[model samples]
Target: MASQPLDPGNSGRNDPALLRLPSTVRHRIYLFLGVARWDGCPLLFDLDGPVSPSDQVTFYGLLLSCRAVYTEVSALLFSSNRFVIHYRNKRSLQPLRNLTPPSLAALTSLKVVLNQASCHHRREAEASGACCTRVSGCFTRKPKGAGGHCLIRRPHKNLHDTPLQSSDPSARLMLEEWRATAVYLSSNTKLDALELSLVCDVDQKEVEAAEHVVAPLLLFPKLKDCHVRLCISPNSHLRQLARNASRQASSNPALEPASPTSGSSRLLITLPREVRIRILEYTDLVAPLKEVMWNRLGLGYHYFSSGCSAWEGVPCLPPYHHGCQYRDCHGQGIIKDGIVRSDQLRSIGCFCGVRHAAFSSTCKCWAPPTPLFLICWDLCEDARFVFFSANRFVVSDSLVSANPWLAYDVSFTPDPKWLLENRSNYSWMEWYRQAQPPRAYPAHRFAATKFLREVVPADYLGYLRFLELVFPPYNHECWPHDGHPALQDWIDTVDWVKDKINAPAITLRLVMAGSRMWHPACPDDRGGLTRVQGIAVLTGYNRILKPLAVLREHGLTRFYADFAWPWKWTNRVYERLRAADDPNTILSWLEGQETLLNDRAERLILGEDQHDRLRSNEAKPGPSPWKMHSGREY
Candidate 1:
């Protein structure tokens, strides 16, 4: 450690020892200096070209120290942080205009902030007492001699004097400003992320305006993440915009099939059509595409039957229930003057100690696929024919009229009527609100229904060859028994198919969701009994053949009652049965259950407990005979 220190030029050496280092070591130093220069420099650049002495010292001070440092650090600066482009006014763009192509090209991320109000408007607000309005906590008084506007938009008199303005600033004034900046920034093909923040009013139109400004950026080549944030101060509006923007941004697919001329085009297009078909055949969809529709939109399960624990809506008691004349109803139920409030009815627990899972007989009516199918046009069609045509789509009578989209053809285009109706409809608004973010499709201008209407092609719906209509339990007396509109949506769909294609081209499957074997032992008055009966009514082939016949009259070629239990529940039930029953008995029962719906369709609907009871000698002969009525005999 005590040896003499080596000297370069000072010791009469020809060249400096530092410069004599390896090229790799030199490059590393260049990188280090490039990053370190920031420590010496102020993070905030001074307005009007960084005139402050410290600002100059931070960037140029080190750069001027040597030519080599300048060359390396200059490029590093552009690639490191996002290039923030703030437009105070027309003349404020001078700094940007002077940026060289190389400097602009080095940038990676861009943030464009557009102030809703112009400098002139801001100045006028300052002059008028209205600008200082403290009534709603929106405006704050500027301290004397301090900066008058936001840190991002400081008071510069020359900024207001600039005469440049967009022709339609009132409507799309921000677009011109965006266009100018976009033209310059887009040249940098390396740009990955872009964020647009709009300082604007908190109103309905604000979202539309922000969307208009942000939509153009999504198509930017190499762009991965794009966000549009609102600038409303209270954050209510800002939060909503963020929720919607994130939802939309997350749904964007990373890769799409390329056109014929693109690089990926050869990879897919060169393959034979039969090979592509064969490839798709290997992929299987376990559940209907509707099961994962929420997943596609980046959300979780939202489907819940009415009056279920998961349903979201106001709850009220039956009209006949006198205000609980007695707090005597256990647990001091919502009672006023010893009478329970009808409104507190939903709080009542069932015999099972859980809330009613579905609408009860006497209670107030409770209101209740993988993305790979979309890979390419050809693949999608092939998969559709194989899956949709082969398997049955399950629908419910209760849901047909619940959603207007199901009842009628929906157009996704930004139609004026659809906007006005959806905006005003309370049900639509409530549903759309719950779907925000993680629960459903991130809230957007168009709800899931509207978005679907816009994106799904007309032809896509046409070729679906098989469909199943499943009705929910119909035994709830208190539930709103809205007359099944004779104007069934499926009938309309069938009619449309008849006009487009040959008769009997489509197969319609009608199904009840549960087995009827348990219904006889179940008490009719119990809510559980009603739930089983709902599916029991659809178990027999004769029960559904009438509706199927009507649908066939319209256009369907084949009609069948599919009494299959939901597979998800089936797997769970089977696991429990396997643990208790002999393996051979369970296997035989399973084989019989598998074909219960498909084997002649008129067999008794057997419940999981029926077989178990029969094997265990717990079975009792039922009054209701398992009589098979033959349709052929009729």
Candidate 2:
């Protein structure tokens, strides 16, 4: 075989002088000769044998040109490019098995594309020693017999004449063959990534079953990366049937057809730009100062919540209408046990009757919507710019000690019950401790903040219109013990934010939580100052609001008095003040004002009758009733 003359094109390439060139030149020439396709391009090794050598020549032509060239380039050919194997039957393994050790050693990544329809037919041919007679076009109409009878076409020889199994076999045999081949390949090569794709007809049920069997085999521990994709043929009968059903249904006037734009439209690129924006606006993408996650893994539903305990009891609310005002909650207040607590504060009323037991329990805590970025690059680009520009990203006070971006690095909190013995100690103080403290400790917040400022790309923040700094609620322990330290850290963070903002004109939201009213004072509480002590509440407000007023003086505009006990009253009294207004004005006015704290303290000092008389005199009217049938007021 070595002495014989090679094929026409193979003859001229057999020059011994080629080896005399510099190694670099030789490697470059070899690269051109060996690479069937560009790097990363799929070099498909069709399992169905080519009818002619010409098809094989397209991929392996240069290798057969000369011995020296083949020796030099084969390794580069295998290693530099990705190899794809199109599998149909047992015969698909032939090329992989035939690979020389050197070629196998050069291999780094392999992708296998399996066609279930072909595999099914191949299996049928193997079992019956022929193609299924029942299938249309399996036999030709041409007659070759003496009596002019039609003749049946013989099955391909590669299948080997064997009886097909009557039942659809679990992918065991197929998987076993693949496993053996995978083990052999692993032994021979330094494989980096293994990808397996299943292409099947539109029987979703059967495709899933086939995928379940074939997918796990791709996950060889030795492979550094693994991916499995399922592609259903457009010609799938099930899809055609579904389309037909939809057409038939649309023809019937009584059957109301759902609007095409009712849900998230997958063909966003195809839609007009305005339509896309309209659709995206409804998503959290455009929500202001709210945490939005795209492609989240938990809940599998659509909802939002202000971070609160999932297990907290529902608040008692008065009559409400879809478009009712915030003060629509009847003059009633938050009723705990049977006792009506202090008159319903607007801050508490904001969350009154709001429940998220279904979503919060399942959601991962503070997880970023990373999957949003995983879609097509164009869509990701469009969405990110729009999202960052439209909404103000908030780094709560706890997160301000460090960069906010770092928060995305933390995973969602798992169910405490799932932790078994590792769960937090739920003791006497646990309720009080958990209630006032930040859900995520400072360290996690710091990491998240760091990630936001440093890790998130500058372009994403280029159009940032707003940034919110939420002052975490202070419990009694947080206030007296750690208040100064927390306040100092927050002030430093505000300074950093002022200097770092990228936008020309950005609004800052300074959110103050109603820490005084966060925990209702318990009667069983002993000699320690009440959770809402007069001096402690006064000092905490002075500590928080003083710095906040400074930031406002420096031009931070949106002061969100979040969860303030008298949300309505507090907003009316304090939020309405000018940007440069003095913090002490409100502080001095509040000092003498009758509030829940003063009422509770006064009740203790005086008797119940005195407080009751005061409460009755100041009682607000209940929500207005619905109009009567005659259109007259009740």
Candidate 3:
């Protein structure tokens, strides 16, 4: 046979032009070519195969280019991507054991899958009918009497046969390997996130054994997010182990007293109290505390804007649109698309809009100073004081409406539909009942109210200087109505605040929107307020303010009600009312506006001529001034 020609793949290794580039430049080139992109999925590794099934074909050519090329890019391949290894047997972890020290040190994220096969050696030993004598609930293979056979014991009842101290030689070896692997990972790897998933058919005893096997890995000090999943039960001993590890790691340095004669701790202690506090402030310890409904990883704030508007003639577009509140506004879309179509103006209607912006917690501009609180007891106290006293905590209507048990309970597995809705990444209005179903609010059990009551420490409540409670826009049919559960929940929350927070300046804000009218074709596409619907707005406004009376009680005079209606002229009216120090001014202004709104409603209902005249004027408009410069779009 003729000798095989040299492989083109191998030939690339000697390419002089590519090899001449600097290592940094070559690394970027490899990354640009998609060598490091895993698209949020973990990179799978299996000891049985040279590479994972998903990547073997794709990376084969590049990796086989030459040993030199592999040496340069292997670090990037291992470090930049998250690696997951599945443990099936004693040798299942060979892939991890094979990684070089440098490659192991560069790892940022890792996940390990432990399954029933991990205990195969123990199962096999039991199947072979090995004889043993029980001593203190543990089975040993040595005979009790000379020349006498030991009695066989059932493996299921042998709870002491944990992987770590198993009678079976293979089982003990496997545990040793696991311990060694855990030691290597904890000492060498720089993991930010680690997950240990035990998806095995296991009883309580087996579960405990599995926990022992993974305990060391759970104690990795540098992890920011550590998750342990036990398929047999909702709770896991390993989960508690992970928590203890996290707590110990965070407090270890501070637990031991620093030498008074030397080190930075002494220098820190020497500084004046004011100077230390000033330095802490610069560390962003005073970030706002806000509530989030989904993927809430740590303490941080999210920003969102909401508004309502009324449109004349045929409504311009959908009632709800998600984008920049001003630039891509649905109301503006009507004007941009030309309000006058086929010599007719769109009918008048109401629009309610809300848009979610970026969350500050995930932004890389600054790291959370929560770790600073764990540095020392004195620092922790100072951090908490600055965090609660200097920043505003906002409790929104959506937070109150959410089912806290479902959202906050790690053990509770929500319905598939609920999970899909939250994970879909759709732009949704948190306050809208149509988008987010409201939980039946119980006075003492409401999620938001309960969080304020029980979750926040009592001492921190005293430190609070500013608190903002935001209620959804008033709906005549629902809000402040007799026996409304949500209304009761709100009242109970205010009562709790009054009782607990004595000195904090409270801001009560009501979001207002024009009444919505559904389009003839699409039920979900709603229009802005009509003349008749405007009456409901006035009635709703009057009813909503009745709840604010609870805030006017003794020691609660620091509170003020803000009616945040987004309409230009309406906003100015509310702004002027807000400028007054007395609550009586707001009530008086609402009374006057209610009377004027009622009069307009009556004329529009009874007089056809006024409706025609209003429509005629709307038909003459080029761009509705209200839509152009709404008080604050979003």
Candidate 4:
């Protein structure tokens, strides 16, 4: 039964003469009858009928009207794409293989047993549709990993069963069938999209097994859309491993996850960087307003690291072997003639902001929050006569100019010898320019850069002070001013491995810096960027200025402490580290704080694995997030 959109009078239900029409006219009439309908409507399924209480009998009679009518309508009658399966526990989803249209008969028991789960409309469905069933609010829920709710339960749950193992195998068996059916449909060539639920654990073995299970089908050539809800226990080795994998995937688009976990309320599992970026690119990321991506734009790493001619000029890498040859040119590797994919473009556009922020990197590096102002300067100096077509700054201008109500400070000024430098000095850009778009940021960019140069340096700093006043640099605040606060981006810290392959530390810095929208008003969705590890939005100037403007200023001014591992304590940790065996390992174990950079700086300077090994029988960090409560979460 479909929700009726037309009145019985207007829908032409009164005319018995409609039944006297020829078969072709009748079929066409039926097609037009169910415009925009998705329910169990007779016309929608291509069957001519006055559907009623005797639906099965009515449909069968229509099927016997004639061979021609039955043939055309029958094809559509069985074309329902949705299927449900259920199983008891996580297993190789092989039972699903039999559900192929050819093998669907093998799972006949599925239909009989799980009929209650069918989405068929009910007389009271609309009336019973209640909101805010969960007391955690409709949006939040307490499930396993993050700790279960000892509090009252949510009444209106999207998932019918519980997150924990069910006591009754009846429910478990039904769940197993559903999972198997999903796996079966996934391998189907015509499946445009899919949805599935699975359990994830913090155990390393679980992560490996999960990957192994999906490895064969994950490589599907036509598979462009995927949705998965997988949750695992907290502090599980698998969770950390997944987090690291996501971080590593910042440059790899092919590996992103398809969907948020069940409640969509809580994360079921940790996703790798590329996958996380993919989700961010598609999701409505509105909270934790202080995220670097919202403020600094360059955090869109995938765009820069890609070889799209539109972004060829920005420096970054695709995901690839740490020491692979040609690591600089093709991070993960590129194929000729591929334009910047929408995913990459959105990410780049999001950072540097399609309007105001511009590309600014030392050519090969990424990260450390560079103030929006400095990145503008880097673009001004790079190339003077660039075309305004390929870059986002132009698009942003168009958007802003159209909306006069949006507050902005985009006016720029040009430098006297803007084009004289010729971009010959930068190491990565100089060599990579052969592959980049021949255009630069244009003379107009200089104006914005210039304005930022004269006006923003202090004002923007004032904004930081305002945030400090309003938000307070609680756990970690003011990145690029120093290493970072606890839980900083993996990008700010360099992948010593990549540097080891590209060049040396000689004044080069790979530091974490909070990022924000380059053009705050721009609406495009670009995922986070950081070529070295997943999820980094980059800025050419930030790469240059973080050390120069932000950190240098902080170190030179000795402004204050209270940043990533704070400047003073960072030194003490290193001193303690020097005395420990397997210092890096010991440092990893230190739980009290979740500082993001101390390890990278040490790795960059001390050389990889050069630090003393700290022998702690227990491999863990002190003051870990599990114990110390710090920072606000949305």
Local distance difference test values of all predictions, in order: 0.35, 0.38, 0.41, 0.26
TM-score of each: 0.32, 0.30, 0.42, 0.27
Number of backbone-clashing residue pairs for each candidate, in the order shown: 11, 18, 10, 90
1-634, model 1: which lDDT tens digit per residue?
6744443333435434444555456556755644433333212221234333434433456556655545556566655543444555442445555655666666544444444222112221222112111211111222221123331223333322112223335436445556565566566545444322223222333555545554555444544444343432223344344434443443334322222344443465467877755654544432312211111222122121111111123222333123222111112223334343443321121100011111111122111123345456665566665554443333333221221112111122344665678775634324432331221111222122221233334455555455445433232221121222232333344344444433356544444433332221111212233435434433332333332333334444344444433231234445656585566676556546645644344222222343344336633221110011100100
| Candidate 4 regions with alpha-carbon error over 4 angstroms | 1-84, 88-141, 144-188, 191-205, 212-221, 232-464, 468-634
What lDDT does candidate 1 reach at residue 628? 14
| TM-score of candidate 2 relative to the true fold | 0.30
What is the per-residue lDDT of model 3 for residues 1-634, given as tens digits with 9 covering 90 to 100? 9754443443465465555566656767776666665343223343345333444435546667776676666767766655555565334578777877776766655555443311111222232211133211122123333233333433333222222223446555566666777777677656543333222222334445555554664556655444333222223343333334433333222222222233564566568777777777755565422212211221233222211122344433443222123321212323423331221211111111111111111111222344566767776777777766665555444322221111111113355686578776522232222332222222323334654666567667767665554443332233344466655765676666666665425432232322112111011211343445445545545554454455445344333333323121244444665687885777666556644553343233324454445445533212112222223221
- Candidate 3, clashing residue pairs? 313-346, 313-347, 313-348, 314-346, 314-347, 349-528, 349-529, 350-527, 350-528, 350-529
- lDDT for predicted candidate 2 compared with the true structure: 0.38
- When sorted by lDDT, best at the front, the candidate numbers are 3, 2, 1, 4
lDDT, model 1, position 374? 49
The TM-score-based order of candidates, best leading, equals 3, 1, 2, 4
What is the clash tally of candidate 4?
Answer: 90
